[model samples]
Target: MKIGYIRVSTAEQNTIRQEILLRDLGVDEIYIDKASGKSTDRPELKRMMEYVRYGDTVIVESISRFARNTKDLLELVDKLRQKEVEFVSKKEAIDTTTPTGVFMLTIFGAVAQLEREYILQRQNEGIAIAKSQGRYKGRKPIEHPDLKSTVVQWRAGEITATAAMKRLDMKPSTFYRKVKKF
Candidate 1:
């Protein structure tokens, strides 16, 4: 079986182009996600991986669609290899079933790592400069004034976690995350 995966950073982004391209490659199925590339907790991506069987192939528009960072991309490919699954990237024109493709992927992983490191370095430099100029301001904290009351109610056994989450209008993860920082 041949499966395709498509991903975009936001709900506003379109998956049509990627789907069309994957279809052209004769993919038997396509999985999609509207989430940031920076996040590893992609539910759709996890589902796609779980759906694959031995000798099944996974296709994507490019490495970027599969992963944002080199570590993630490399690790995912390694896992797929263990499953006897082949990975194909249309834009890269590389298929993991070939030795040459393995070589290319290694190089690509190195480049991606270097790119990530460079970006982090530049960000650090910019932060230092901004701090030196007394203009550095860290990210603003999430605020939900009603969250405190809801948390209190939940803690006091007046409400369930679900009730507190509903009252606060936040997802379970969001509620827990905010509660931790709140």
Candidate 2:
């Protein structure tokens, strides 16, 4: 079976392009995750790992979609290898069943990791410069209808944290952080 995997970093991003491309390639199934590739904790990624079998091929749009760092990429590929599964990256033209592909994958994964590190370094430098110039305001606070009232209710035990978070359309972490500010 040829299984496809697609991912985008944020909820706002669409996976349609990756899905269409994978479908065009005639994959038997496609799993998608709209989460950061920085971690392997994504639900669809876990599902894809459990769903593959020996001799199955996992196709991804690119190596970066599969993993953010070389360590993670190699670890994932090694896991697939142990399961006798072949990995194919469309953009990279890598088929892990070949020795040459394995070699190229290592180099590509290193390059990708380096690229990410450089991006982070540049972003930090830019933020520092902006801050020194007194123009670096972080993200603006979100406003929601009755947000303060609802938070007060939650804090007073009139509503469950879960319910409050749902009402605010926020994750637990964000909700708790907001609670602290209130």
Candidate 3:
């Protein structure tokens, strides 16, 4: 079976292009993850890993969509190898079944990692420049009408932190961070 994996960094990003390409290539199954490729912790990725069998081929739109770093890329490919599964990256024309393909995979993985690093560096530089000009104020704080009351209840032990967070529709990190500011 030819299994396809498609990833986009955020939920808002579309996977249409990757899906179309994979479908055109006659992929038997596809797993799509609308999460950053910085880590292999995505739910869909985990499901796909468990679903694949020996002799199956895993295909991706590109190396970056599969992994953001060379280490992660190698580790993922190694895991696939252990299962006797092959890997193919469409854009890079890489096939793990060949020796030259393995060599090229390493080089391309390194280049992808370098590209991501450069992108981050450039983003940080842009943010710094904007900050110096007083144009980068960061994200606006989230406000809820019942936030104060919720915090008071939480502090007085009238409600659990989890309950307060749910009432405020806030995540644990956000709730704790906001509470710290009180």
Candidate 4:
């Protein structure tokens, strides 16, 4: 079986391009999510992982779509390898079916990880300087009228967290942060 996974950070984004590419590669199933790939709890991705079986091939448009960062990517790949599954990243020209793919993947993973770390380090430094200068006021709190209702529904088990998230149009992190301090 050939499976595909695609991710984007926002609801306004579309997965059609990646889908078309995966379809051309003969992917039989495609799992998609519109969450910031920075986290591991994406529903569709988790479902897809649960469904994969030995000998199945997982295809992704690129390394970032497959995982949020190198750590997650390597962890997922290791899991798939343990299950005797293969992973192919079309854009990166990586295919786990070959020895050279393994070597390239290691190099690529290291570089990608370094890049991410450097970006995060710079961001943290900037934020710290801004905060020290009293210029780092965060985003204004959401002012939606139904936020309370949504939180009630979510806490009451009347609606799934995902449903509440969509209704609020907030990322999981933002939603939870608001809920906790609201």
Candidate 5:
């Protein structure tokens, strides 16, 4: 069986290109994740791993799309290998069933990890510069329309705390914290 995996960094990013390529390759099933590859915590990725059987082939658009760092990439590949599954990366022309492909994967995985580290370093530097220049205001607070009324009602005993929390769509801890601020 051939299983395809497609991923994009955010929900807004399209998976069409990867999907089309995987479909063109005649994959039987496709799993997709619309989240960061920085971690291997994606739901679809986990599902695909568990779903694969022996003699199955896992097809990916690229190494970076599969994993953000060498450690994660290698670990995932090791898992697949243990299950007797093969890995194929379309962009890198890597097929882990061959010896040369395995060697190439290691080199590419290292390069991917290095690239991720550089990206993080540059992002941190940019943030530090922005902070020093007083341009970074940080994330804006969420404004809930009924929060004030709900908190007031909860405080005044007109509504139960649980009722107010339900109305505000907040957990007990969040409700109490906001109550303190108000």
Candidate 6:
């Protein structure tokens, strides 16, 4: 069986392109996760890992889509190898069925991780330059119509912090930070 794995960083991102590519490649099964590839904590990824059996081929669009770092990429491939599964990356033209392909996969994985780091470094530099030019500001503060009333209730112990946060539709960090500012 040819099993495809697809990932997108956020829920808003679309997986249609990857899906089409996998489908075109005649994949028997596909597991998709609309979550960052920064970690292997994704539900679909875990499920796919468990679902794959011996003699199966695991296919991905690219090494980066499978894992953001070389360590993770290598670890995942190693796990697949242990399970007697073959690994293939369409974009990188990598196939772990041969010695040369395994070597190329490692090289490509390292390159992908380096590329990601470079991108982050460039973005941070651009943000710094924009800040110095007074063109960059942090994210705008979130406002709620009943923020004051909710805070008051929270402070008076009328509601739990979690409840107050839920009512305000704010994350714990955001709720605490905003409450502190008040």
Q: What's every prediction's RMSD, in angstroms? A: 3.7, 2.2, 1.0, 5.8, 2.5, 1.1
lDDT of 2 at 150: 96
Q: How close is candidate 6 to the true structure, as a TM-score?
A: 0.95
lDDT of 2 by residue, 33-87 (tens): 9999889899999999999999999999999999999999999999999999999
Candidates' lDDT values, in order?
Answer: 0.87, 0.93, 0.96, 0.87, 0.94, 0.96
lDDT of 2: 0.93
By lDDT, is 5 or 6 better? 6
Question: Judged by TM-score, which candidate is best?
Answer: 3
lDDT string, candidate 6, 135-177, tens digits: 9998988999999999999999999999999999999999999
- For model 5, residues 1-182, the per-residue Cα lDDT tens digits are 99999999999999999999999999999999999999999999999999999999999999999999988999999999999999999999999999999999999999988998999999999999999999997888656899888878777899999888888888888788778888
Over 2-27, each residue of candidate 1 has an lDDT whose tens digit, in order, gives 99999998999999999999999899
> Alpha carbon lDDT of residue 53, candidate 3?
92
Ranking by TM-score: 3, 6, 2, 5, 1, 4
TM-score for all predictions?
A: 0.72, 0.87, 0.97, 0.70, 0.86, 0.95
lDDT of 3 by residue, 1-182 (tens): 99999999999999999999999999999999999999999999999999999999999999999999999999999999999999999999999999999999999999999999999999999999999999999999999989998999989999999899889999999999998988
lDDT by residue for model 4 (1-182), tens: 99999888899998889989999999999999999877778999889888999999999998877775777888888888988899998888999889999778777877767777788899999999999999998887777788999999899999998999999899999898889965
Off by over 4 Å in 6: none
Model 6, residue 89: distance off in Å is 0.3
Error of 1 at 84 (Å): 3.1
- Candidate with the larger lDDT of 3 and 6: 3
Q: Higher-lDDT candidate among 1 and 5?
A: 5
Cα displacement (angstroms), candidate 3, residue 177, comes to 2.2
Question: In terms of lDDT, which candidate is stronger, 1 or 3?
Answer: 3
